[model samples]
Target chain A: QQPVQSPQAVILREGEDAVINCSSSKALYSVHWYRQKHGEAPIFLMILLKGGEQKGHDKISASFNEKKQQSSLYLTASQLSYSGTYFCGTEPDNNDMRFGAGTRLTVKP
Target chain B: DVKVTQSSRYLVKRTGEKVFLECVQDMDHENMFWYRQDPGLGLRLIYFSYDVKMKEKGDIPEGYSVSREKKERFSLILESASTNQTSMYLCASSFLPRTEDGYTFGSGTRLTVV
Candidate 1:
């Protein structure tokens, strides 16, 4: 099943921070984060496996709560380049991965 | 660098016509997936293959089929193209299932059915 993402859309100014959340109805084995700019393929950001596991990529980081079947992505000091759609891919115990609807983030100057 | 390449970037087909979308991964990944991306629906999986000659239907597989004759190439086939089938199709490959390694995605093909 596909996960549900909150704050379908968000707007931020440069140097601001934003958080996107994803929740799934099924138990999760791992969670992956990806960002896609307009007309571009989604790019992998990070993958979190164990409960409470957190991984960071520059100003972006994500945490997975296996128990809660949820994951959250944190974008710190956002830049204009950060404007894109963020998707969370949830992998259940069955090893099937499905993506959330995604959160549109627009970073302005 | 690992690369997942989709054969077409854009395609336009008439209704009732058959269409094929090809994907190739050079990383020797064991898992390949086909997904269609829509405006607000996100990416919906149509089919996936874990090995050559093996395929599984994904979340949305109706009106679609897949081929994995070779380990590196995966193809998604539309039995009969319809207007509703128009969308951006994406291909991805992963080294392992439920592994820490993230998937490598292709640029995607924008298909339009008239």
Candidate 2:
């Protein structure tokens, strides 16, 4: 099933913060985060495993709640480089990975 | 760094023409995937391969077929192109399920069926 992502689009100023949430109806083994710039491929960001682990990359971080079947991506002190469409890919089980509709973030100068 | 390359960045084909989108990964990963990205649908997996000569249907595989002749190459074939098939196609590669790095994707091929 496709995961649900909150805030279809967001606009922020430089150095602002934003959060994108993803929720799935089924139990997820892992939740992956990716970002795609205009006309570019989606780039892998981070992945949270089934053990309820959290992952971070510089100013980008994510937390997975196994019981809630949800994941949240936190962008702290967002930069202009963060302007893109963010997608959360959920792996319910095995090797299959399904992505969310995506959250478009535009950070202005 | 792992490199996943798609044969074309843009392609145009007729409605009834056969289209082939090729992807090659140099990392020798065990898994390769083909996905299509539409405006509001996000990335939908069309097919995936675990190894050479092995293929599996994904969530949306009705109009597509896949081929994995060698370990590094995975191909997506559109038997008969349609206007609905005009979208951005993406390819990805991964090591295995147990790993945490997840998938490395190609730049994508923007295919247009007119």
Candidate 3:
């Protein structure tokens, strides 16, 4: 089954922060995050394994909650370049991986 | 940098026409995938090939087929194109058996079936 994402769309001002949530019903082996700009391909951001690790790059960070079978992406101090669609791909096991509908984010300067 | 190349950037096809979309990966990755992206539908996997001559059906693979005759190439075939099949097609590749591996995606082919 496909993962579920919350807040289908978000609008933010510069320097603000936003959180996007993704959850799955099955035991998640890993969670992958990707960002796609307008008319561009999706780019891999980070991957969180089952070990409950929190990974970050610059002001973007994410956490995987193994117990809840959920993951949240945190965008701090949002910039204009942060405007795009964010997708969360969930892996139940080595054989299956699926992505959510994606959360559209628009940041205004 | 790993590069996954898709042959056509845009294609227009009539109903019932046969369509072929090709992808090539220079990274020599073991896993190649074909997915279609639609608005509000995310990316739906059409098919995936792990090795040459080996293919697996994904979540939405009923109307699609794949071929991997060589290690660097994977092709998706639409036996009879329909309006519903019109969408942005993306090709991705990654290392096999690595649950945490991040996929490298191609620029994508926007196919329109009329």
Candidate 4:
């Protein structure tokens, strides 16, 4: 089944911060995050395997909660370059990875 | 850098025509995948190959097939094009079993079926 993402769309000004959440009904062994610009393919950002582990890239970071079967992506001090759609792909116990609908983020300068 | 290359950036085809989308990866990854992206559905996997001459069906495999004749190349074939098949197709490659790194994707092919 596809994961569920909260706040389908979000807008922020420069230096602002936001968090996008992804929740799955099934137990997840891993959660992968990716970003995609308009008219482009999705680019890998980071993958979280163990629960309670946090990974960061630039101003972006993410955390995975194994017991909750959820993951959250954090964008700190948002920049114009961060304007894009972010997707969370969840790997359930079956090991089949599936992507969520994605959260469209627009950062204004 | 690990590079995944798709043969075409844009393609136009008529209904009922056969379409082939080719992808090549230089990272020597063991797994290659084909997926189609639509407006709201996100990415739907069509097929994947774990090894040369080996293929597996993904979530949505109907109306699509795959071929992996060489270790570095994988092809997605649309037996008969339909209007519903017109979308952006993406190809990705990954090393066997998930590690820290994830799949590397190609630029993608925007196919238009009329």
- What candidate 4 gets wrong by more than 4 Å, as runs, is none
At residue B71, what lDDT does model 4 achieve?
A: 97
Show the colliding residue pairs in model 2.
none
Residue range with the least summed lDDT across 10 consecutive positions in model 3 chain A: A89-98
lDDT of 1: 0.93
Give one digit per residue, the lDDT tens place, for model 1 in B11-113: 9999999999999999999999999999899999999999999999999999999999999999999999999999999999998755567888999999999
lDDT of 3: 0.93
| Per-residue alpha-carbon lDDT of candidate 3 for residues B1-114, written as tens digits (9 for 90 to 100) | 779999999999999998999999998788999999999989988898889999999999987899999999999999999999999999999888874559899999999999
Chain A TM-scores, per candidate, are 0.97, 0.98, 0.97, 0.96
TM-scores, all models, native as reference:
0.98, 0.98, 0.97, 0.96
lDDT of 4 at B36: 89
Candidate 2, residues A1-109, lDDT tens digits: the string is 8899998999999999999999999998999999999988889899898878888899999999999999999999999999999999999776788999999999999
Q: DockQ values for all predictions?
A: 0.82, 0.81, 0.75, 0.73
Winner by DockQ between candidate 2 and candidate 1: 1
Docking class of 3: medium
lDDT of each residue in A2-108, candidate 4, tens digit only: 89998899999999999999999988889999999998878999999966799999889999999899999999999999999998998866555788888999999
Q: Extract clashing residue pairs from model 1.
A: none
Give the per-residue Cα lDDT of candidate 4 at A81. 91
| Pairs that collide, model 4 | none
